[model samples]
Every structure is written in structure tokens, then in C-alpha cells.
Target: MIQEKRSKRGALLGLAASILVLVLVIVLENTLAPTSQLFVVLKKGAVYSLVAVSMNLVNGFTGLFSLGQAGFMLLGAYTYAILTVPVSAKDTVYYLFGGSAVKFSLPDLFGGVDTPTGLILGVLLAIILGGCVAAFFAWLIGLPVLRLKSDYLAIATLGFAEIIRAIFQWQALGPITNGANMITQIPTFNNFNITDESGKVVFRLSAFFPMLIMIICVALIVMLINSSYGRAFKAIREDEIAAEAMGINLAKHKMLSFVISSFFSGVGGALFAMFANNAQAKVYTSTMTYEILLIVVIGGIGSISGSVLSTFLYVACSEWWLRGLDMGSFLGIKLGLFRNGFRMVVFSVVIMIVVLFFRQGIMGNKEITDLLKPRKKTKEVAK
Candidate 1:
């Protein structure tokens, strides 16, 4: 009873703290000097956090080692880009296709290109459609692919992603996908900007829009993980044969988890495209999926908080914040030893140290609250 009360209090505190942090970020993003590089990293990190959680839902919670996140992301990014790109911009964006096969734009269909409200709805719809398309593809792939176990499953999923990439790049699909060319001018989070009459910044759109989207995605995953179905997933993860013997339908549950994961990965991809200012099939490579998997591993499988935390760390250290490693200066001194790609070299070394020393990862399959408890009591609970 006492432990339960402590846990509840901890959760409440965490919630309050998260809200405070959200508000603080909003204020900083809008009122402070135009969105800083740090804010850019944070926004990107939020998107990554969402994808990592989705990946965790399958690979960590469900004990599926699927490696098709990049494929799903490609679907989402392309769907979003193709739909949200301005009709006026399509011919130019799809110059390679002579004229895009998709002559009608989603924004125009919804009155979005001409009006603010429609623009908002259309952008939101594009994001939703992106997820739906990815989920549909996941369903198709999951039908046969989900039957495989372990490494075979991983290979099959990875291959499916490659096939999807190839299809998107094919000439026959050139009209819709632009045939290996990048889809640009898609409505980004920046499109929702609210500015002053004098063009002075008021509420920054880019940071908050994507942040809100990511939060919603993360919330959905949490709800799913805590639901009764989550228990079935956990059971399957522990022992699939045992779970099946106990009346669980392994196929149904696996398919559901896979579809859900793919949906969010697609959404994340769309946000990533917006951040990157373009979507190209080449950008959604296997190497990118491996990076997300590395985050899940570093964060502790089955630990959502771990995934979220590690995402910020990974993005900050590896991409944006650690640029100093490549620069000549360090602190107050000029370091001549540091050179190009040093950030990645340092990132790899750090990952190796984490893998070797922190066997269970940063959070180690535990919630953030678990860290708040007495170490002895937490260890007791783990045992």
C-alpha cells in the first residue's frame, strides 16, 4: 500500500514536471530569439522519440526484432510529401515526371491552399493519411512476414522495406512518387506560423506543432502498452509457446503490434521530412533504421522512458549539439587534432562504452519512477 502511494505521487510529479517543461519550451521557442539550433535539435529529437517508442512497441515489448522502420518511414514521408505539396508547386517539384501523376493536391481538395483553417486541416489530414498508408502496407507485409520468428523475421521485414524503396523509385510509379526524385515544398510545421502584423515573431509554429504531434503519438503508445493487450504482448515476449498454450492468438496480436508500430514510424517519417525540407526514397535507408535500433538498445528494451531519453541524447550528441567536435575550437582552446566525421567517431566510441559498461542500458527496462525509489527497494522489486 505504501509503495503504491509512492508510485502514484511519483507519477503525478512527473506529469506536472512534463507539463511545466512543455510550457517552458513553448515560451522559449516563441518569445526568445528566433528558434535556436538547440530548439531545432529538440524538435527533431521529439520526432525521433516518437519513432523509437514505436520501434520499442514491436522489438522491445513484443519481442519482435523487425528492422523495417525505415520502410515505414519512407511510406509516411512520401505520402505526406506527395499529399501536402502545393498544387502550384507540383509541376516544378515533379519536373522529372513531366507532370505528376497526382494532378490533384490534398490541400486544394480541402480548401487548404486558399484558407488558413483548410491549410491546417489539410496538413493534419496528410499526416494522418501518411500513417494510414503505412499501416495498410504493414498489414499486407505482416500477413506473411509476421509468421517468421527471430532473425528471419528481421530479414524479411528489411527486405520488404527495400522492395518498397525500389517500387517508389520505379519509373511506372513516377507520376505518384516522382521516381527517385525528392518531393519538396510539402507543408511543414513552419506553415502554421502565427506572426505579428509587422512580421515580428509571435508564436513559433515549427517547434510546437511537431512537439504536440509527438506527444500525442507517445501517449497512444503508452495507452496501448498499459492495456490488457499489452499483457498478452508481454506474455508472448516472455515465451511464445507458453502464451499460445494459454489461449493467446499469437498471429492476431503480432499483426496488431506490427501495424501500430508501422503507423507511428510513418508519422515520425513525415515529421522528419518536414524537418529535412524534402523527402527522397534514398533518405530512408537501412542505416537509418539501425540507428533507431541502436537507440532502443541503448535505452533498454521495453522501457518507453528509456527510449525517449536516449533519443534526445542520441540526437543531441550525434547530430546537432556535438558539432564542436568537428570544429577546431574546444572550450577556450583550438584543438587541431579534431577533424571531419569526429562526431560520428566519438558517437561510436561512446556507444561502445555504453554497450560494454551499461549492460542493461540507461534505464534498463525500467520506468523513470523506478529510479526514484530507494535503490534497495527498486532492486527488490526487480528481483
Candidate 2:
């Protein structure tokens, strides 16, 4: 009963905190200019947070070192872009290929593209479709690759990603994939902003939209992590042979983790496309996977909150906070050594320092709520 009370209190505290954060985001969006640097950081951070957490689900929780996140994301992005692009813009977007093979757009089919309800339903459907596509591919790939252990699994998945990228860019598939070209004109987060008839902005929700999605997705992942299946995953991660000995289905849990991770990664990819206002196969490269891997590691492998915190920090440092380092001047100090790609160099060094010193990472498989708990003070009586 006491433990249950503590859990209930924690739940209430967490809910209160989440509501406060959402309120804060709404207030900031309305109070500040739409172009504020904070918005950029928040929007991108939210998207990356989802992907990072998805990757963490497999790598940290299930002990699967799959490196095909970019491939799944590419699938998701293309699925979303191909399905959401306005039919009128099809000729232009796929002009090089003569026209998109797909005739209908999701938004158009729902209730016409202009209706608010239709737009919401259409985008939601498209995102889910993207995830389903990714999960399907993950299942197909997992059949053989999941049998491999450790680095071999990683190599096979990485190869799969490269192959998928190549396939998506093949000229013969241009009608569907756009063949090395970008798919644009899809509805983006900016569309969520409320505007007057004359196009004057009334409320900005570009950041809030992604934040809301990220929170919901992350919450689902958290609940899964706290479930029986999640425990089975952790058991497999700790000792596969031992897990199997304990009556756990290694193959089943592993496949479930892989598919779920890919599903969310695909959703993240769709969100990424919305954030960028375009989707291109070339952009979802091995480098992207490595960047997300770095986030997972730097955040601590098994911690959901760690991934969220680290993603925001990583994005902000690379995109905004350390940007001056690339301009050859920071804090009024100008130096030739700081020019161009110097920011990344400094960022890389900082990452190394964190890794070497902290080792287990910022949270080390612990969530933010772990810190929220008060420690009991012990009294020492000396004679």
C-alpha cells in the first residue's frame, strides 16, 4: 500500500509536470516571434527525441544492435510524402518521372484538402501508414538478420539500409520514389498554425504540434517498457541463453522489439519530413543513423528520459548553441581555428569528454523521475 501510494504520487507529479510544459510551450510560441531560435531547436529536438527513443527501445532494451534506422526512416518518409502530397502538385513533384504512379492523396480522399478535420485525419493516417510500411519491412528483414548475433546483426542491417537507399533511388522506381529527387509540397507543421483569412498568423503551433506528438509517442514507449513484454526484453538483453532457459521466447521478443522500434523510427521519419518540408532518400544516410546512435549512447542506452534530454542537448549544441564556433567567433573571441566545421570538432571533443568521464552516460539507464525522489537523511549518534 505504501509503495502504491508513492507510485500514485509520482504519477500525479509527472502528469502535472507534463501539463505545465505544454502550457509553457503554448505561452512561449505566442509570446515570441515565430522565427525565434528556440522554436527551431524545440521542433527539431522533438522529432529527434522520438527517433532516439525508438532506437533505444531495440538497442538498449532488447540488446539488438541494428543500424537500419535510417532505412526504416526513409521508408516512412517516402510513404508519407508519396501519400500526402497534393494531387494537383503530383505532376510537378514527379514531373521528371512523367507523374506519380499513385493517383490519390490521403487528404483529398478524406474530406477535401481544405477542411480542418480532413487535414488532421489525412495526416494522421499517412503517418500511421508510414509506420506500418516500416514495420512490415522490419519483419521481413528480421527473419534472417535477427538470427545473427552482435556486430554481424549490425552489419547486415546496415547493408540492408544501403540497399534500400539505392533501390529507392533507382530510375525504374522513379514514379513511386521520385528517383534521387525530393518530394515536396506535403503538409508541414506550419500548416497547424492558425492564420487569419488574409494570412496573418493568429497562433503558432509549429513547435507544439511536434512536441505533443513526441510526448504521446514517448509515453506509449514508457508504458511498454514498464510492461511484461518489456521485462522479457530486458531479460533477453541481459542473457539470451538464460532468458531462453527461463521459458521466455527469445525470437518472439526480439522480433517484437525490432518491429516496434522500426515502426516508431518510421513515424519519426515522417515527422522529420514534415519538419524539413521535404523528403529525399539521399538525406537518410548512414551518417544519420550514426548521429542517432551517438544520441542513444550519450543519453544512456536504456533510459527513455535520457534519450529525450540528450537529443535536445545534442541538437541545440550542434544547431544553435555552438553555431558561433563555426563562424570563427564565440563570446567575442575571433580565431581562424574556429571557422567552418570547427563547431562539430568542438562538439565531438565534448562528447568524448562526456563518454570518458561519465561512461554510462548522462542518466545511465535512469529516468528523470528517479532524481525527483527524495533521499532519506540518516542521523548518526556519536558518544
Listed in order, each prediction's TM-score against the native is: 0.92, 0.95
lDDT of 1 by residue, 160-221 (tens): 99999999999788888988788888877676677667766566766878877887788778
| lDDT tens digits, residue span 88-142, model 2 | 9999999999999999999989875567876889998999899999999999999
> Local error of candidate 1 at 104, Å?
2.5
Model 1, global lDDT: 0.84
* Model 2 weakest 10-residue run by lDDT: 374-383
Each candidate's lDDT (Cα)?
0.84, 0.88
Give the Å shift of residue 17 in candidate 2. 2.2
Report the alpha-carbon TM-score of model 1 versus the true structure: 0.92
The candidate scoring highest on lDDT is 2
Q: After superposition, how far is residue 199 of candidate 2 from its true place, in Å?
A: 1.7
Clashes of each: 0, 0
